[model samples]
Target: MSMTLRKRAVLAAGGLALVAALAWAFSPRPLAVQTAAVTRGLYEQAIEEDGRTRLRERWVLSAPVAGRLQRITLREGDAVAEGDTVAWLQPGAAPLLDARTERQNRAQREAAAAAVQRALATEAQARTAREQAELAERRSAQLAAQGFVSATQRDADRLNTHAARQGLEAASAAVRMAREDLVRAEAALAPPAAALPLSRAGGQAPLRLRAPHGGQVLAVPLTSETSVAAGTALLEIGDLRQLEVVAELLTADAVQARAGAPVQIDRWGGETPLRGRVRRVEPAGYTKVSALGVEEQRVKVLIDIDPDQPAAAALGDGWRVGLRILTLRQTDALQLPVAALFPRPDAPDPQGRAMAVYTVDAEGHARLRPVTLGGRNGQQAWLRDGLAAGATVIVYPPAGLTEGARVQARTP
Candidate 1:
């Protein structure tokens, strides 16, 4: 063989080798994947958050008026009934006017009364004048009709009658004004009503406070020497016998909580888990900034605890409670994880709602199949109307795999 011929043969062999290597790299091969058996299990698609336990209702009693606490029998933690005499208050009296002020006030009252009397007298005189004017007008009108007086005389008499009516109305209004002034002056001199027994401002004479509802007194801050002002919180009472848990949740999670939905309240640091139902999902969400500076809108969800349950007996106010809000529950239902679905490379076009899955065909070739899905939560998706159970489903597909590609499930 010649040297030139040998070099040409070596070049042709190298080019063919390069072409075969490129085709193998581009060709579809077996993809490594994890298989999930389509079996029935708990499916929850939800966002979990730390929930807090709060009292079902807290009632803080305040003083009705300012005064000295005359009598107090009940102590802290004592049960009180409605209209119970929790505290008796000798209310502080209004400041009395001095003798001179009283005398002046009295004088003003008397003047008002005299003015009223004068108005009455004036009103009586006006009524008499109206009667006289009416009689004169009638006489003039009769005379004018008989031709003894001019037609103008009748009009003048009518004008006088109208003037008399106006005068009567004015007199009546004057009498009313004088009477009102007299009443107002008398009321001003009257003493003030009793002050609130318990007040927010601590003073020598504390205001009297009592429980508004029939419950055990949880706290009574008012002491013998402690003073209080109006609307001051003196004590707190709640029906310890009847208690419920109130938990705050993210607004998104709250929407999943349906009314009358079952709640599994657990990790209450109690002996046993308590069962509850969704009583209410607060309609409003408050702006809350989390520790990570996450601006989140949160709402409160109330779970009515059956007090007879074990958790409720051990529960107290402000206990940390966990709530599992169930979105959907069905026995013997088919479901799959959403992560199992992979988009097909040869799929017609991309539409967001459509979910595509690459399933292993009997021929050992990868086939892309379109499957419809239903509601899904945190980890699982409901197999609403597609994908029969007892079939092998692929989960978490490997990269670089396309439809109808020759592949094998390494696990099977």
Candidate 2:
């Protein structure tokens, strides 16, 4: 073939390759376009969530002694304080309780007190005998040396002293044991604010559930006159003066939790959102199955509401609210929505700590921009380096677009 003809054929082939590349780059694809604006604003990186409201300090009211729901003077939502009598229960009718059981508890307490007294008396007697035995031992030793007492008698005296010492020790141990028993008996008689329900299915039978602490009545489990089982729930108690926001976060989210993380809460039927701070993140995790039935670990995070805010008063215990925890925040930063950002897969590693994202130059080309991302929130991220303010970036660019691919900016 002639040299001129060979050159012309090569050029034609190159032209076709370029045209194909352009067609592929120009194809349509769903993409989100956003602008990088220069503004002085606070960028908060918070964990967004929806959760229920609750009193910061609330207690359940339960029966201290077994009894039926004889009468409940306070209704649900009634305000209560310490030492206030909320309910009057019948003499008998608690789940796991009978008249005999009530009498048994009372008898047990009196018996415990009597046993404690006996232990003290026995201890005192043992101490007195020990002192006498010790004196006898000294006297017997002197008499033996002077030949006034026989060796056998001296040995008998020593043995008596030893026996008295053992008796004293045993009496002391008994006294200690009796006191401990009394403590246990008292605790057994006392009822927890939220007692483990008498029955998981039924609930704690009417022993008037009392308010564990000063708080509001949240629920009346037994309002109607119906025969309840051993573990039937009677009522619920809580204090709304103190409130906290609780969120059920997945295990992954909880692992990243910190003590001072900021949070935002949105109450149900509320117009405005409120801010909060993370007070605690539970150490333990719970089993939760995702919609796909995949087993997952979940955790509870408690956020404390700021009292300075006006919305705090409107909140109550067990009320529902939405939360946004501020995991990170940046002031005066180059922020960009994740949708408008791109990661260059084939970019070479520069120095330490460098990420790549796509930017649209005035020429309408996908410019590979190396950026340093500092912090991020739910949607937008803080760009610390490699990106300038007011730079337009291609979100989902056209297919086959390269570092220098031609892209036409859709009119805003």
TM-score of each: 0.56, 0.58
For model 1, residues 266-310, the per-residue Cα lDDT tens digits are 887876767766768889899989989999888888766654455
For candidate 2, give the lDDT of residue 376.
62
Candidate 1 residue spans exceeding 4 A from truth? 1-29, 40-47, 64-94, 97-210, 249-253, 343-353, 362-365, 405-412
lDDT of 1 at 291: 89
Cα deviation at 338, candidate 2, in Å, is 1.9
lDDT of 2 at 202: 57
Task: Estimate the Cα RMSD of every predicted model relative to the unseen true structure.
Answer: 24.8, 21.7
Encode model 2's per-residue lDDT on 46-79: one tens digit a residue.
Answer: 6666788765443444444444556455687787
Local lDDT at 388 for model 1 = 70
Off by over 4 Å in 2: 1-41, 56-58, 63-69, 90-213, 224-235, 347-354, 362-365
